[model samples]
Target: MDEIKILFLSHTVDYSKAPYDTGNQFIQALRNNNAAYLSYVQLYNKYGHYGAHHYLKKYVRDNGINCLIYGSSPSEFYFDINYLEKLRKEVFLVMMTGDTEYYYEIRDQYYAQAMDLVTVNDFISTFKLRQIGINSIPYYAYYDSTKYSKNGNLAKDIDVSFIGTLHGGAGRWHNIMHLSANGINIETFGSDSPNGRITFEKKIEIINRSKINLDFSGVSGKTRLTRKHQIYKRMKQIKGKVFEYTMCGSFALCEYAPGLEYFFEVGKEIDIFHDKEELLEKIKYYLAHEEEREKIAQKGYERALKDYAVERAVPKLISIIDGLRKTKTYKPSEIYLDEEFIRNYTTYRTLLIIRFITQLKFKFAFEELKIILKYRKLDLYQIVIFFKEEILDMFPRIKSVLKSIFRRQ
Candidate 1:
């Protein structure tokens, strides 16, 4: 039998000083399994949206890639459905997402319908997608055990620590502040924290050193206007950090999210809190009871190592992928991409282009422009319509006046 040639497309660069992030670890897992001839292409930041899709299709055809795994995100919007439909015939295409809670309705579901299989990070999302007739499976986030493991020598001085960005109005700041106000000596280390962003090694070190590493399942604050309904909603999901914290042999006090119990036994392997009061109570109990804390952490670490380590998880994923390839059928859905949806999508893409240009990212802006021109075919009428909406969006007064005028008409 010929070796299954797989092309993994994702953004691999660690924007921070971290040597390697999750994407790199995932690729390493595939290689370690020796399941297929894996080839990687750094998408998004490297090639923009349209460029990434164009390059991906060409790469797959040229390199005989029978399996294509896309680390899908909402950052890039230029994935032409027609293009995906054609490519699905050639390769067993799969889409993986960790933030399905936020993007599922706005972006992911449309793309997922075109995929041969969809792997989600949370069980609830898996169930939701499957209910809707999509071939979805629970693929929990795995960690590099080499980097994230128990360091017995490191002293657990920090009582509690949260190591992630605090931008999302998803109540992370509120939670941290609430804990601190109630006399919990909490330390935060992320983009908006006092410590700012730290290296990947530093993150792992902190996790190992902290008595209780905090994990918030809330989505990031990077949602679009169309997705405003999700803003500050604090809809929790099974985050990757849940595994990352436990894998370091550290006690993880996570915000309770539905379907988290499927991954770890709450209060046995790990612990969770639903509200601020519960979280505060748990922290106090855990802090005083050092032996109990350590026991839970140890059990969590053992579970993570045995089940969620990249080495163990990847092989299972490959087996599932193989089985899926043999049995799954391609059924593309086009109902979601109506004329109104296209206009909204194009407007969002235009916003991204404007943002890129303002940030002096000319290459990305140019790439977006090229794709918009080619696919959208924006003529005088469409351009006029876009700018009018853009103008109305920018000025509330203008929108009111326009509405009043239309109403008078």
Candidate 2:
């Protein structure tokens, strides 16, 4: 077979600029295997949607770009479905769902028809998409082994550390505060934390320096504190930090999430906790037993290097992509076009608009409105729901009564 040329498209220039490093690791892994002539474009940053569409079409034509991997959601770029469909004929289009829990219904499913394959970050999401007849696969987030290897030279000064955001409704702040109250000194570093966010270099250093690295696998819903948001905050999924912690040779005590055991042997390779009490108890035990903690950390590091490295996973991804090209059996689902489905999805979208407006993100709310109008005309029911939510914000007691009435039905 001929070499597969790839074009990696993302919203940011590179990994350093990106909020997450998953895309960069994938790009690096492709290069490591000498797969093909790979080119990268930060479409949104370089050009606006219209300009990006024009440039992308011309660039793909001028250059022999056979595969295009989009790292961001279709909604963020706002690419026309027709434009994507036309491009699909020429290239193997793959879309990556970074936050599948929230955006899969609102954003991803709408574009799955245009994609040759959709790569979900978690296992449950992959299964969900396949059930709906979309060609999907679990592309577990991997770490750059070259950059995140075990560093024995660093001193383990910190007791426990968490290197992610604590904002939104994930309940991370509550957990951290609980641990602190119980005398577990956690050096927190992320948005909304006392220390604030750290640099990429600092993150690696902190992970290695900390005796026990902490991970919260739960998903954060909308910033607004709603019943739905509260439910979402309790939902768990495999986190990218799981690989990062192990790759850095740090003993991780991650929050228990389903499907985590498939990747690592719990209690042997890495540890997990179900609640704040367990997390606190485990932290104390591990801190006291140095040798046991070191053994688990070493095992996790070996496992991560062998199985979860980006270099190791990219070949499998390439094979899957190649096989997909040969078979071409994937059929787009018409479920997104169903009237009842559209109505439900629109209701979800309106709730998101309310979320944005309440959070003072007027621009995002306006963009969501545009997306809503593009597909289906706004109806009286949607308008009523929007106002009802707004009024509910004013009268909490009345809102609670209505919430219970709806739940019982």
Candidate 3:
């Protein structure tokens, strides 16, 4: 039988209008090649929060799930657990140890249950897993490199560019200080900049043009439960943005991490530094050696396309699932019928309430709905009309909706 691949559970805003949305980009890359029997379902939670954990299990049985992955892209902020109850398949948690120790405990518990654990580094709790006899692997977080190109001439209009929060904490302040003290021509950008956020392509262009783009991560430890201002500090696991910079053919001078040496040969693939001094020295050397710098950028670009894309990463997950099938220890996932009923209740409730109120309002009496529907396409009016017809058949129970929406409620 062919293997099934599901890129599971995303929490991101839509990006149809935005030039770049990382979650949307990930889904795009994973679906790009049409590799495996690939499909996707966005995560759901009740109360407009993360859905029940058991719901995932049931969805699997109904849909015939063969694999599940917790997509571990970086977050500018942390959110609460919402959809744990619905998850059923043996999971693969792709965690990168950063400033937050949020999932450290649950990660160990899940690993103990024969589920595979994938982290970017050999973290502290990772070692503990092996001490107690658990199997896990290091899966490098990947980026879609093809989108970025190494066109002629680097655009260095902006010197010493930086992205990310400016005032999330002290680390950001430190990054600003490091670049300024070095006296490299640099421009500060991101949340710390006058207005936060930049376009994905604009970000890439900025890095390509700048001599060195600073990549620094920030974390606040007080997770509504702590005394320490900075909780967990593992500066090594630099993620998607690093690959992004490289793929654009821009040289990155980033913090040192263990496995990074494998992807990048310290002085070659890109540059790294222990502290402010070491980083400054390398930047000066590379600025003088443009040829060497370009060579390194090309090398990093090659490596990124080869190893850090969806084509390179998805197969690893598939193989692990096949190995698990040989062991055959899991109970097939199952979801109760009420879950579907609840979904129906949830989906239509908000849509109907808004639609009905609009129809019944004086605007229908006062003017054309189109004047108020400027932003909303309301392309699904046919579907809404059909549904409201059903409610209309049921009588006064839904009469309020019609009065409001149709100006009759």
- Candidate number with greatest lDDT: 1
Model 1 TM-score is: 0.78
Clashes of each: 0, 0, 31
TM-score of each: 0.78, 0.73, 0.63
Cα lDDT tens digits for candidate 1, 48-67: 67666677778788888878
Backbone clash pairs in model 2 (N, Cα, C under 3 Å; residues 3+ apart or in different chains), count: 0
lDDT of 3 by residue, 58-89 (tens): 55556655555555423211122223322333
Minimal lDDT window, size 10, model 2: 36-45
TM-score-superior candidate, 1 or 3: 1
Scanning candidate 3 in windows of ten residues, the lowest lDDT window is: 76-85
Residue 45's C-alpha lDDT in candidate 1?
43
RMSD of each: 7.9, 8.4, 13.0
Q: Rank the candidates by TM-score, best first.
A: 1, 2, 3
Cα lDDT, model 1, residue 13 = 59
Candidate 2 lDDT, 49-160, residue by residue in tens: 3555788888888888778776664324245555777788778888887767755655677667678889987677777778776779877745778777778899999999
User: In model 1, what lDDT does residue 335 have?
Assistant: 38
Q: For residue 339, what is the lDDT in candidate 3?
A: 31
Model 1 shows how many backbone clashes? 0
